[model samples]
Target: MDATVNACIGSDRLFDSPTTMNASVAIESEMKWISGMRPILSEEDFFTWMSLIIYVTLFVALIGIISNLLVIITCARIGFSETINISYLALGIADLMASATRFYGSIFLLFEITTTKVHFDPRTVSSVVAFLPSQGFEKTAAFITAFIALERCLCVQFPLHVKTIVTKRKTIFSNVIIYIFAFGPSNLIHMVYRFKWVYNATQNRTVLAIDQSETRLRYILARALYAYYGTILNFTALIVVWICTVYLVLGLKRKAVARKENFKTSFIKDNKQKDLQVIKTVFLLAVTYLVCSIPTAITLLVPQFVPEFGSTRALARISRVSYMISGLMMQVNSCTNFFIFLYMGSRFRKALITLFKRH
Candidate 1:
């Protein structure tokens, strides 16, 4: 998920760096522990790599948008007869939106780099178009992936009963709930923070600033939601997905060894192959999601147990870089699923092929 955004305790927004804001505002808004905190990387060194990171992010966003779009279209074409289909569709939408927002940020940064008329901080561009939306979508994807893993786990354990339990109507409702609970809260960003133009006298340029003029209650609510995305939502998803993935992996090994006997009980040979393929596809997705999620997960989770690892504590510097790395990995997560399905999902591949032939 979102670990940090140059500020945001990996995504919590508590540490958001609004450099152009008044010093009094900064003091009032920020945690006292980070009053003079510094990054591990020297300013010179970090700036040197910033452009390359932006370019890489741009590339990731492009690939993610196109790939997730392919998945979205394919799932729609294939129909949502299975909970897996609807789950994939929801995830693709989330990933696509995240990538799209990040792509806009990439372009915003590229413009900043090229234009001489104004000097814009990366954090400013990120706040305007990237971090909040990305955090929301990432949260959405995290829960969706967990749901898929759990759904698959049940299918593996109770093959005949899963469809009955996770019915189409129920799945549709669950997805609606996921969207509301996971993605809807992000709307608070708009209510809580407004953007304004500020001229930077030192740099001799105008810059974008995040103006905190909202009600205290609104700000507190958004802050809590942001914390939820960075911590509770991700933490729960990671644990659930990890447990389910482990169970599914072990089940796959056992099922592989007894494929003939297990499927023969009721499922046809073709259905057996399809079911196995779906499992493998979901396994790859869950594994990639977990891998990408770890940096943020560890960064966010550690502060809860050991206060020193917090955004304002000893690990703050490393936490910042860790969050940045996790951000890159998150983009990678958004884009890589297309390849996973292309290689492992026969039904997905067939649907894609059929779609192209129709075109």
Candidate 2:
């Protein structure tokens, strides 16, 4: 969602200075719509569909966030003193943040959809309430996953070195650095662009705009930073994880071969199961990240080539639908991490079970 909002707002063609247009005609036309456009909920059956989906998404996001928070808290309190486990705790916190942000952000979006008046400045509110939080949580999750991969790599490649260097303090410090790096650019962009109202002739509503050249520059820079650097970094880490997982699986296979040769019958059987479980978990995480993120990434690049597509009604509708679908995918990203933990991680599943038992 961070990437989507930035892409939408950063498009120079999307919002030109309304002040350049005839303000008098714009104001009169906007007022006419305000006076005439009645609420369609009474007449429209589709309102029910919209309402149902919004409510369901909100409920799922809320529950997912709460469940993740409980997992993080429980793990913090009860997890063993392993630096590797600390990474899972950080991941839970990041997932919870993403889920909570999506839930509240979706409420605002639902209001925007249903209301006659544009309630809030989309640029500013979206920057703070939607973009910044999304970027923060996403980057945090990415870094935490990368750190987990690195830890696993170290453990597999140099067990003695991992035992000596992977400390709790180190993990905490790394988490702090990841958050600062992840959130810094988006927050800075929000501060620079402070949202303002602009009269939108097409929509006949007071919509939000950046409204200044300097702010536009900042928005573009921030969007570019995330699109190129942050996303690339995430993809790189994902590749590293895949490679490391494969390496680990191969190593386990070699060990099984040796154990079989030595006639250690049980040694190959039990540990192979554990190795398979870990492989499945890592593969799921990788696939989930790719599926959730690719659409948003493509959306970020859409504006650059939109002129090539031209301005047809069908094209406009397609673009709008794509944007909505991409936004939904982001919400799925926030909610699905918990399910991944439930299915893949024994520790997370145990923690969740304990949490439910207590409640």
Best candidate according to lDDT = 1
Question: What lDDT would each prediction earn against the true structure?
Answer: 0.69, 0.56
RMSD of 1: 5.6
| RMSD of every prediction | 5.6, 8.4
Q: Candidate 1: worst 10 consecutive residues by lDDT?
A: 17-26
Question: lDDT per residue, candidate 2, 1-359, as tens digits?
Answer: 22232122212332211101011222222223343343332213323443555576688678768777776776776675767567767777887887787677666546544443464544335445564466567666766766676666565566448667888898888988877776565455545455677765534677765554565676576556545333565556556656665666666565555545655567766754554565466556656765676765575456567752213322432343344445556556666766776877776677667777888
Inter-residue clash pairs, candidate 2:
none
Candidate 1 global TM-score: 0.81
Candidate No. with top TM-score: 1
TM-score each candidate.
Answer: 0.81, 0.68
Error of 1 at 60 (Å): 0.7
The reply for model 2, stretches above 4 Å from the true place, is 1-60, 116-119, 122-124, 159-161, 195-234, 245-255, 258-280, 297-313, 345-347
Residue 75 local lDDT, model 2? 71
